[model samples]
Target: MSELNFIVTLFIAVLGPLLAIGYLKPILLVVLDSLCVEPLPGKIGAHFWVRSACVLAVAGALVLALSFGEFDGSLMQALRRALWLAAAGSFVSIAFITSRVWAPVQRRLNAQLNGGRG
Candidate 1:
């Protein structure tokens, strides 16, 4: 691929999963909330794992679906690419969620440690 094409492809590969996760996360949270599923007390790990699984599943399925037609080359190669993209997307989504969840907590803890000056 030309440099321009490579850059565009890279951009789409990185952004696609983020956009998918961004759109799906709120919907998933709403559905879970409506089901009255409460987070385990003092247990963020379980929530993180569940969310990670969900992100992987959604990203994988989307990649699989789109790969058949959207990607070039042999089936196996396309599948390999799809899986890699899905994994990358899941990691990005998880990192984003982690930062969003922890940033405020970190700030609050800092404030407490510094005698409420933060």
Candidate 2:
């Protein structure tokens, strides 16, 4: 393939899907809000972490699948790749969740120590 073709293909296959997946949650939330659905609660609530992890994992698999072009590869290989992607995505999600959970608590503690300063 020519250099230009390869670059375009790479961007479309990898970057496009990733960008779409990254925006999926926010987009859905906006749509739901537009429909007058009940406002969602904070992420610290029950099952929020698990749900986020699943979404991220599935998004990761889908994003990875966009670049899958080998017709002769074994099913096991594909499954392994998908599983790895899911695991990595879940880890990253958990890290974000942990920081999110900690940040508010840290801020509250700091405020108390600082004599109720905002």
Candidate 3:
């Protein structure tokens, strides 16, 4: 039971983000790309942070609820396991998104500072 829970938790942590990106990446990209103040996108970083946190929080709550119950072979158990996997995956996905969004900007900024065209 413990092993199952651990595996489910790990799966959730890993897979949730992958799915999130697969589904929500376009929106994320648009938000990130529209960050320039000249065009007035209205502060994407704050909006993105809030949206990500809300989604993560809801997914986390579902995972916690699913993973805390007694062991059983019922349908609820199966759903709970699935939710656990999703939660874990969601976290991983966000981490990936964060890095993806920040890495390029950081590199470009560094290049500009170094007198490069970026």
**Tens-digit lDDT string for candidate 2 (43-97):** 3332344455446545554455445522245554544554455445545554664
* Ten contiguous residues with the weakest lDDT in model 2: 29-38
Question: Cα miss at 71, model 2 (Å)?
Answer: 5.9
**Which is the winner by lDDT between candidate 2 and candidate 3?**
3
Tens-place lDDT per residue, model 1, 12-65, is 554556566666666545433333335543235444544664556456445543
Per-residue lDDT tens digits for candidate 3, residues 54-84, read 4664466455545563344554565576676
For each of the candidates, give the backbone clash count: 0, 0, 13
- In model 1, the runs with Cα more than 4 Å from the true position are 1-72, 116-118
Weakest ten-residue segment in model 1 by summed lDDT = 34-43
Better of 1 and 3 by lDDT: 3
Q: What is the TM-score of each predicted model, taking all chains together?
A: 0.42, 0.43, 0.38
